[model samples]
Target: MRILIAPDKFKGTLTARQAGEAMAAGVREVFPDAAIEIVPVADGGEGTLEAALATGGEERTETVQGPLGEGVEARWVLTGKTAVIETAEASGLRYVRPRVQSALSAHSYGSGQLIKAALDAGAQEIICGVGGSAMTDAGSGALRALGLRVMNNDGARARLGGAALSTALRIDDSGLDPRLKDVQIRIAADVTNPLYGPDGAAQVFGAQKGADAAARSILDDGLRHWAELLHKTNGTDVQIPGAGAAGGFPASFLAFTTATLESGFDLVAELVQLEKALDGVDLLITGEGSMDEQSRFGKAPLAAADRANARRIGTVLAVGRSTLNLEDVTGHGVKALAAAVDCAPSVDEAIAEADRYLQQATVVALRNLDEG
Candidate 1:
């Protein structure tokens, strides 16, 4: 039997590669003679850079400012004329501890610095993966770093960060780097929220940035204003689908750069030629940190499973946890589902024992694979 293993990162526990290895080990215990293929997947969020870099790319490192003005070293991945920039590398929430989560004060200037560096390096196309962001600045700081000035009514340049966005009155784009005009910018994003509304950026993502009720309202208002200005300056609408991604980074990029939004997993799958790997596979195993309703909406595992199902291949999902309704996934063609914590002392313990649980689960699952 040929088995394909493809899984996303298990959040705080294991990376997709590690999970695939563990799952492969379990399958080997059940069927020692079976052929297995492991393909690690990412959802264009936190692990995007790692996934892209794994496919062999030229990596460049630079020192840039962090979300809260701290200096930090970050890296970008380049493959031929295409440059990959992960926003999380510069302004990710991981840089801020729980106690220091401050959406109002956080900025995406460092991400802009990386973009400038990529453009300066003569990249013909740039892929900006927006995920794990810590700010709600609507990409204002990023634009500033790229030489677009945001000024208040008094004509002074606006300060960096989301809080200063409420005071922005005029946007000056005269100083935008000339090279950026010729570059194609693609935004790899997973979310589909618009720029402003109930499902907008601040309402859907601000709480994670440490925005309380008042802050949420403030950020929402600021984003609305930013969107209005962008709509006026650029002829394109800023309230399109996925405009709220990366705290409205997509909207900003759509307005300023030659940008288009695409599903991150789909992009990765095409890049890695996952469909080609599905040929002749008897059973396919895929997973993520959690399996839920959202998983159906272009998550990495779903993408892999879909490709495998197209070939009439059986697919099983082994996840850290399964919050999805079984019926919901049944119609979509997943053959089996398994969760890592079979019998754990506690949630913490379950997380700590994820690899062992996955291995054991895979062994048991394969035993019943042909039975059911």
Candidate 2:
């Protein structure tokens, strides 16, 4: 049997690579002579940089500002002149448990610092994976770090963060880093929310970052004003789909530079050459930390299964858990389903020793597939 084990991160427990390794071990147990190929996948979130590095790249680490201006060690990858960066490495929600007020103050300056570092390393193309952010500044903080000045009506520099963005009167890009003028920025994100509205950035995702109803209102209004400022400064429309990702992190890049948004799963899949990896594979196993109806829309695992279906290869899913039963996924080319939560004694135990539970679940899923 030829098996390809490709799984996304098991969120908060195992990384995509770790999950693949565990699944690979289970495959070895069930099909002792099976030819196993592991191609870890990511949907352009926490593990995006790791996925990029796995394919081929020179890893670089730099001390950059955190979401709340604290220093943090962030890592990125350079493949030729193209640099790959994940916003989570610098200004992710993992750095702080923000309250409504703190969420207003969180900024993405660290992400910009990473971009500067990439530029310093002779990068001309940047793949910015935007997600897991802890801010709602419309990427102004990042642009500020790149020398774009936000000013108040009184001709003074505006304060940083989302709350301050509400007072932004004008933008000064004269001092902005000229190097960015020649850079091509590709934002990898799975979201499709606009910059600001009921279905937009703050209103849709604010609560997850600690914004209350009132605070969400403030953040959404600020995003609206910031979008106007960007449109006035440049003829750029920052309210495009996926602009709301990572707290509107793509807005600044879209306004100030040549930036485009692409599907996170597609970008990562291409980066890892997932198509070539699926060639001639009999079974393609893919999954993530969770599975549900939402997983059908651009999530890595389903996307992988879709690819497998195209090649007439059978696919199985090994997830941390799932809201859907076996019947719910059979139509999506999933031949078998294995959830760690079902195999382990408890959900907590499954997460605590995710590698073990994942391995055991993969074995069962494979055995079940063989029988079917």
Candidate 3:
């Protein structure tokens, strides 16, 4: 039987491609002659660029500022004149140390630098993958790097950071680089948060960026102010769903550029032709770091399962962790839910032993495939 192996990255452990390879190895151990296909997936979050670049793209590197006010190096993928920038490369939370969680001081200037570099490289279009960001500056820093003037009432230019958002009095779009007007920007975000509200950028994602209760409130208010200014200056609304992704970066892109917001998974899936690969496949195996209620809403595993189900193919999920009620996943077309920690010493230990455990788990899971 033909089986499709598709899974998202296991977070701190293996990448999606590695997880697929490991699972494929296990599947082969059980059914030596089984036809298996590996498809790595991402939800427009971390590893998005890697997944996209896998389908053939030119790689380029640039030195840009990290989350904190520090010099760092990052990379982007370019396909012809279309460049893909993963926000995590410049403003990811992973850059923050436990002792230095300064959400206020982080910036997206490096992301802007990457975009600028792409433009300088003669790119006519840019695809920004917005995920795993550490700043909530409403993309002000990015705009700043593009030569937009974010100034205070006294006309002094504001520094590149989110903490200055609350103090900004004016945004000068006339000073924006002329090159930006000719470039098309597309934001690939996995979330659907609006610019401001309970489900808005700061309220929903700020805490993860190391914002405390006070910082959360401050960031929320700052985003609100920025959004209002954006609306006033651009004469267009900035609070559309998904506009709050990547710490309100999408809102800024919407306000400043002719950027279209799209689902990262859907875009990548179409690029990879996952649906075509799923056709005629006897069984589809998909997974992620964890499976839960959130998985139903455009996540990578769910996206794969949805396509497989459309073809009436059986789908099984093998996850590093499982939090969804069995009924929840079963009803969503997952024939079986397998976890790597079936008999591990502890959850932590299980995660540490994920690769080995997944191998053993897959053997048993596939052995029962024919029975079902």
Candidate 4:
């Protein structure tokens, strides 16, 4: 049997490549003679850069600002003139765990620095993955790094993070990098939240980033204020779907440049040539940390399953846990399922030993399919 294993990261536990390796081990246990190929994938989040580099690229690393003004080593992929930058590499939420008060001060300046580095490297196209952000500055910090100065009521540079945007007065882009006009910027994001409102950035993702009720209110207002400033500066007021992703990161690009928002899964899949990888595969195994109703839409696992199904291939989805039942999973063209939570003693144990539980679950899933 020819089996293809492709999975996304299991959050803080296992990366996509690690999950693929575990699934491969389980496949070997079941069918030692099976031809197994492991291809890790991502939906333009933390693992986007890795997925882009999987096929081969010039990996570049540089010291940039972290979520809280600290220096961090951020990595990106430069393939020819196209560059892949994952926001999580610089302003990732991982760096600000238990976010608390710092969430209000976190900035995306590092992401801008990454873009500048790409420009300096002669990139003609830049694909930025926006997710897992630690700030809700509506991409102000990033724009600032690109020479867009955000001024406060006092005509001075505004403080970093979401809160300070409430008092932000205006912006000046005269000093913005000239090369940005020549580059094609694609913002890769999955969420459909607008820039600021009830279902917007601050109200939805702010709490997770350590914003309380009052803080969320402040952040939401700040985004609104920032939106007005952007409109006054660039004559563009964008509030499109997916603009709220990564703390309204796309809003900045949409306002200042000709950047367009694209589906995260689609962008990365193209970069990794996922469709070609699935050709002639007998069984396609794909999954993420959690599989739920939301996963049925544009998530990478479902996208991968769709590709396999187009080729009349069966699919087995292995995940840390899933809210979808057999019927729901089957409706999505997935033939079988393997959940680490089912194999491990507890949810904590499942995450603590994700690799071990994932392998065991994959083995059981294949055995069950055989019995059926």
TM-score of each: 0.94, 0.98, 0.94, 0.96
Worst 10 residues of 4 by lDDT: 97-106
Model 2, position 91: C-alpha lDDT score: 90
**TM-score winner:** 2
Give the per-residue Cα lDDT of candidate 2 at 311. 87
How many clashes (backbone N, Cα, C below 3 Å) per candidate? Answer: 0, 0, 0, 0
Q: Which pairs in model 2 have colliding backbones? A: none
The lDDT values for all models are 0.81, 0.90, 0.81, 0.88
lDDT (Cα) of model 4: 0.88
Q: Could you tell me which residue pairs clash in candidate 4?
A: none
lDDT of 1 by residue, 1-372 (tens): 898887888988988888989999988887899899887777777776666666677889989999999998898988878888888899888888622247777889999999999988888988888988998888888878898988887899887877677788988888988787899988888988997778988888988888887787888888888888887776668888888888888777788877889998887775556777788889898888788888889888887877877888878877777787445676556877767765455667769888888787676556656567
lDDT tens digits, residue span 1-372, model 4? 889998988888998999999999999999999999888888887888878777788899989999899999999999989999988889988888645577788889999999999999999999999898999999888988999887888988888888888878877889999998999999999899999999999999998998888888888998888887778876787677899999999998888887999999999988888888887789988888998888987899988888888788888888899998778877567888879999999999999999999998899788877876
Question: Which ranges of candidate 1 are over 4 A from the true structure?
Answer: 98-101, 343-345
TM-score of 1: 0.94
**In candidate 2, what are the lDDT values of residues 45-155, reduced to their tens digit?**
778887887788899999999999899999999998989999989999989897997789999999999999999999999999988999999889998999999999889
lDDT of 2 at 93: 91
Identify the superior model by lDDT, candidate 2 or candidate 4: 2
